[model samples]
Target: MLLDRHRSLLFVVDVQQRLLPAMGGGEGCVARIGLLLEGARILDVPVMASEQYPKGLGPTVPPLRERLGNAPVFEKITFSCARDETIRTAVLGTGRRQLVLCGIEAHVCVLQTALDFAAEGLDVSVVADAVDSRRASSRELALARLRQAGVRVVDSEMVLFEWLERAGTDEFRAVSKLVR
Candidate 1:
């Protein structure tokens, strides 16, 4: 199903400092996520951010954190964001059924979170190019598994364009600039 902007929530899970360098294609993943953030801002989509463990992994990478604005930022030790009480509550409170996901360690955090969200009956759409693991194979496998479990596997531009839903409007104009 196509994501409805008004019914969608953006979840950026643990794109931290210490963990990123080890990830394959991590920089490009972060860049795509930045595009998602920019598009979300233009479309008025709600964003929820998480840092796995701030004391150890460091903050949510300065570039992304800066774009987060006043969106709720939850700190958690849980691998699956859905398993964290605060993050789970915030997500449920948004009342949105469609979740657009991005973040790190696709085999671990991203994988578990996507599975949990799916189990909860949320329509989860993961931006494939916006997430990666330390090993390229692990990332690919996790994405394959997620898709097998019924998640919408998509790319960054697909999401932004879908969220825009049309051309010629001010939101579309602003969002188009981000992906371009």
Candidate 2:
């Protein structure tokens, strides 16, 4: 299904300073996520972020934190954001059924969160290129498991374009420049 900007919310999960260095292709993942955030802003999609165990993991990386603007940031120890009451309420409160997720540790937090949201009947999509684990093998396994369970696995570009839905407008122009 095409992503509808009006019906979508971007959920950035645990792209913390301390955790990011452990991710495979971590820098590239952050870059893609940055693109997603920029596109989301241009398209007027609401954004929410999570920091897993912030005391230990530190805050979201400076680049992302700066871009996050006023987006709500939830702190949680739960691997699945859907399992965390506050995060879940904030997400559900948006009334957005389509969730675009990106962040670290694909095999754990990202994977579990996707599964839980999908099971709860949310239309969940994980941006594959924007999420990673310390091991490529683990990321691959997580993506495989997500697909097997019927969560849509997509890339950042797919999300940006889908949200844009057409070309030639100001939103399109701004979002296009982001991926360039």
Candidate 3:
């Protein structure tokens, strides 16, 4: 599907420092997610991030922190970021239709947030490769459930290329190198 840069927002969910290392194949997902963010930057997609109770889990990773230095980040006690007023307000304030998601504990924060957003009648895309649950079975179940519920599950590359869209835009060359 076409992912218009102006109509979409990237939501990085609860990929806190302590929780991150425990996600299955998480290190790889984190690095790929960083690349995804880079592509979004080149394409000019706005981004919002979240941390699930930072006092206990810590902040987002250093690489992501540096890239998104000034982007607003909300700390939440709820599993679903939709439950956090600040995050909800910040996301709604963006005036974007589609929410593209990526990050950790796929069955918890990622899954819960996607379900809530979808229920809010917003189009959602779960970047499969960019999300994790720490447990293989749990992630697999979450993905299946998300699909059944009509959330469009995708990979980082899909969102990146969709944002780029055409072959000749200035972002193409830079984004092309990313997928390879």
Candidate maximizing TM-score? 2
After superposition on all C-alphas, the RMSD of every candidate to the true structure, in Å, is: 0.7, 0.6, 0.9
Question: Which candidate, 1 or 2, has the higher TM-score?
Answer: 2
Residue 17, candidate 2: Cα error in Å is 0.8
Please identify model 3 stretches exceeding 4 Å from their true place.
none
Give the TM-score comparing model 3 with the true structure, all chains together.
0.97
Clashes within 3 Å, all models in order = 0, 0, 1
What digit string (tens of lDDT, one per residue) describes model 3 on residues 50-165?
99889999999888887775778888999999988888888888889899999988898999999998888789999999988879999999999999999999888889888887
Q: Mind giving the per-residue lDDT tens digits that candidate 1 earns over 1-180?
A: 788899999999899999988898988999999989988988899999999889999998888998999988899999999999888888988999999999998889999999998899899998999999999999999999998999889998898888888999998878877766
Give the best candidate by lDDT: 2
Model 1: lowest-lDDT 10 consecutive positions: 171-180
Candidates ranked, most accurate by lDDT first: 2, 1, 3
Q: Find the 10 residues in a row with the least total lDDT in model 2.
A: 171-180
Cα lDDT, model 1, residue 61: 89
RMSD to the native, candidate 2? 0.6
lDDT of each: 0.91, 0.94, 0.88
Error of 2 at 46 (Å): 0.3
